[model samples]
Every structure is written in C-alpha cells, then in structure tokens.
Target: MTYFPAADRYREMIYRRAGRSGLKLPAISLGLWHNFGDSRPADRQRAIVRRAFDLGVTHFDLANNYGPPPGSAETNFGAILGTDLKHHRDELVISSKAGYTMWDGPYGDWGSRKYLVASLDQSLRRMGLDYVDVFYHHRPDPETPLEETMTALDAIVRSGKALYVGISNYRSEQAAQAADLLRELGTPLLIHQPSYSMLNRWIEHDRLLDTLEAAGAGCIAFSPLQQGLLTDRYLTGIPEDSRIRTSVFLDESALDNQTLARLHTLDDIAKRRGQSLAQMALAWALRDERMTSLIIGASSVEQLENNVAALGRLGFDQSELDEIDATVLDL
Candidate 1:
C-alpha cells in the first residue's frame, strides 16, 4: 500500500519561530536519538517517522553519534527519507550534529574545524543528504578555541552543508560566547539544545534561557520526560524492559523511594489536568515562552501520539504551576 500523509497534518500541532530566525519548528519535534538505531526494527522506525509527519512534527533531530554503534540512526533515517518522505524533503527540518567522539584518534572528536568539517561530511554521506536544515556543534570543547568552533560552523553554513547552525550542552557562559562569535561572523546562533525537565533545572539556575533570549536564539529541550522516569514507566518500579534501568545517565541511585514518591505526586497533578504523566511533563517543560520546541524520543507509534497530545493542553494556571513546583522541587 502507498503511504499518504494525514490530510489535516497542520491542523493541531503548533510551530514557533526558532530564536529570531525565519524558521519555525513544530512544538513537538521528533528526535531520532534512540529508536532509529540498527537494533530497532526498520518497519517500526519507518512507522514512527511517517506518523510523526502526519502529526505536523516537521522537525527531526539527529546526531552523528546517535546509534548504539554510532551513525546508524542517520543511516536508517536516510533510508526512510529516500523512500516515504523523498518528495517532502522541503517540508521538513532535518538536523544533525557533531562534536562527540565519532571515531578513533584525535581528529575524530571535539570541536576542531577538521573534526567538525570531516564529521559533517561523513554525516551527509550516511544520510544521503546534500545538506541538513540545521547543523549543530553537539557540545562545547574547552580544549578548542570558541573562535575556531564557531568559524567551522559558519563555514559549514557557507558551504551549504547546513542552512543554520546551533550549539548544544553549552552553559550560559559558553552559550553567550558562542552566540557572540557566531554573530560577529554574521551567522548568529540559531538555537540551543539543553537538558531541561521538572527534575533537571540547571538551565533555569544557569539562566541559559535568559542568555538565549538576549542573543536572539531559540531553545529546544531534550529529556523533558527525564529518560522516561517522569512518565508512568517506573511508577510501580522499573519494568523489566525499561531502558531506564540500564542507562548510564540515570543510575539506580537516582531512582530511590523519594524520587518515586515525587513521581506519584506529579502524576496526581497530571491526572487532574486529564493528561498522562508524560504529557504533563512535556507541557510543563514548555511553560516558559522562551522554550521554542521540545525533542521527544518515542519507542512506538502510540507513545508518539500520546506525547504529541501534550500540545492539546499546554496551559497551566498559577495554582497548577505552584503545585507542580512544590512536588518536584520538594524531592
């Protein structure tokens, strides 16, 4: 059977401008960080991407090091693009990043012009793309000069390998500096990708949002569900198949009884709002207008739909906000 998109794809989802850039990203963008890897079924991955597009998720985020083996996510997404979405290329925002350890040896990692340039070249080849809609430096490199990293991003844009450039995992200080350098070079930072959720509030204390607002850049949060902990996946204890049990980022120590209690408290608030814990988490993460979008990783089509349903009720009154803060912050 032939694949055709939902007729009213744009009817429900919302799009917001990325910083001051001309681009507008869907409020709930799909991320290919986990499920697009080689170990996942190809048919399942294809279904998720197609369903996401049908829901008005125009942006798909990727990194060069996304897969278990590295680079396989881009390879898989490229196959999807080549088949189902070839004609809709211009309707989507495809992004890829570098600055992680992609291969062996010194030149294979970090923020040198050599590594960034070479990594993106390999990324384009793997994705079978002439250029990505946005290319990001995945993280800050203390060893590399800010000027060199920003210059490399500028050059990538100039060469047409990417239309816009962004930075991720940067603190307010680092992000401010990158924004300045990119501005001086005439490109300007387009957006910032940060880890933000009710659990992780470093960006709030770090004031990264204020910095991006000042720099005329946008912010998109990843892990808003805190790697599935903020959802019902662990309310009754970790499921046998739950990846949260094995993640290096969220060790067992992080899921103590206190944390579980907090999850239940938060879920109670979500139930009042007529939403699942996952949906509430997504809505809460975007409460601030400065947050331009969110990158959500889904393991199944049902999960994707449930997450996107967050868009239906993104509002929270002062009382709801205070109640949520009291619960998550108390733990």
Candidate 2:
C-alpha cells in the first residue's frame, strides 16, 4: 500500500526555533532509539514513523549505535525513508550522532576526528541520507581534546555532511567550552540533548539549562518519561512487557517504594489536570520555554498519537508547578 501523509499534518503541531538557529523543530520529535530495529517487525516500525509524520513530527533523532545489533535502527529508518518519506525529505529535520561505542576498533569510538568522521559517514550510508539536518556528538570524550571534537563537527558542516551540530550528555562546563569552540569556527552550537524528566532533573541542579540559555542554544530532553516510570503503565505495577522488565536501560529496582509513592502522587495530580500521567510528564518537560522539544520513542501508532496529544495541554499554573515540585523535587 502507498503511504499518503495527512494533508493537515502541520496544523496541530507547534514549532519552535532551535535556539537562535533559523531551524524550527516540532515541540515533539520522534526518536529511533528503540523499537525501530531488526528485533521489531518492519511493518510496525514503518507504521510508527508514518504515524509520527502524520501527527506533524518533523524531527527524527537517531544515533550510530541505537540498535542491539548496532546500526540496525538506521538501516530500518533508511528503508522507511526510501519507501515512504523520500518525497517529503524537505519537510523533515533528520539527526544522527556519533561518539559512543559504535565499532570495536581503537578508533571506533570517542571524539577523535578519525572516529567522528568515519562514524557519520557510516551513519549517512545506513540512513541513506545526503546530509542530516543536525549531527551530534553522542557524549564527551575526556581523553580527546574538546577542540578536536568541535573542529570535526565544524568540518562536517563545512563539508555539507550535516547542516548543524549539537552535543549530548555533556556537562555544563563541557557544553560551554564546545559552544565557544564552535562559535569560533563560525558554526554556532544549535542544540543540546539531555536526559530530563520529573524523576531525573540533573539539568536543573547542574545548571546546564543556564549554560544553554547563555550560549543561545536550544535543548531537547530525552527520557522525559524516565523510561516509562512517569507513565501510568507502572502505576499499578510493572507490566510483563514493560521496558523495565525487558530492557537494561530501566531496572525493576528503580521502582522502589519511595519512587512508586511519588509516582502515584504525580498521577493524582495529572488526573486533576485532565491528563494521563504520561501526557503530564511530557507537558512538564515542555513547560519551560528554553526546552525546544522532547524526544519520544513510540512502538505503535496508538502510542504515538497518545503522546502527541500532550501538546494540547501544555500549560501549568504556579499552583500545579508548586505541587509538582513538592512531589518530584522535594522527594
């Protein structure tokens, strides 16, 4: 069957400028970190991508080693692009990252020029892309010079392999340093990807958000649901098919008595606000105007639609925020 996108795809989604960059990303971007690999059915992955686009999600985030087998997610996404989204390429903001353990060799990982360049080339080949809209360094490399990594990213943009550059999992000081180097190279840092959610608020405490604001860079929060902990799926108890039960990223031990109690409190607050726990979690992440988008992963179209619906109710008054702070922050 041919895939025809929804005619009014852009009507409902809210777009925000990525920092001072001219690029505007949807408030919710789709991430291919999970369920878009060989382990999942190809039809299911395609459906999720199609549904996300139909809901006006223009940005698709990926990394060099996102799959269990490594690189399979990009290959799968490439197939979807070739078949379903090839014509709509101009409407998309595709991103991929390097700096993690992608291959096994000594030069296979980290922020070295050799590694970043080779990894991105492999990523482009796997995703069948001429150039990704945003390419990121997946993490900071302590051994490698920051200048080396930022220079590599600048070279990638100058060579037309990536339209813009970003960093992920970098601390406040590191992000500031990278932003300064990129500015010197005439390729200002566009965004930063960080793990942020009710359960995980390191960005607020560490002042990374302040750094990005000072640098004029946007922020996209990953793991805004804390690997499903913020969702209702864990309200009663962990389901058999939950990520905590199956994936290493989340652990059953994280559902401690105190955390579970806090989750219930948050759930109650969500209900009062006319939203599901998951929807409230997303809305909370987007409550800060400094946050450009939230990167969400969906296994099914229904899940994608439900998550996108979070956009409908993004407001949080002072009282609601105070309650959330008492529940999540005070915990």
Let me know the TM-score candidate 1 reaches against the reference structure.
0.98
Error of 2 at 317 (Å): 1.4
What lDDT score goes with residue 241 in model 2?
Answer: 93
> Candidate 2: lDDT of 268?
95
Candidate 1 stretches with Cα past 4 Å from truth are: none
Give per-model CA RMSD: 0.9, 0.8
lDDT of each: 0.93, 0.94
6-119, model 1: which lDDT tens digit per residue? Answer: 999999999999888899999999999989999999999999999999999999999999987699999999999999999899999999999889999999988999999999
Question: How much is 96 displaced in model 1, in angstroms?
Answer: 0.5
146: Cα error in model 1, Å: 0.6
Cα distance off (Å), candidate 1, residue 249: 2.1
lDDT of 2 by residue, 1-331 (tens): 9999999999999999888889999999999998887899999999999989999999999999987579999999999999999999999999999988987889999899999999999999998999999999999998998999999999999999999999999999999999999999999999999999988989988899899999999999999999989888988888999999999888989999989999999999999999999999999999988999999999889989999999999999999998999987765
Model 1's lDDT to the true fold? 0.93
Candidate 2 lDDT trough over 10 residues, lowest sum:
322-331
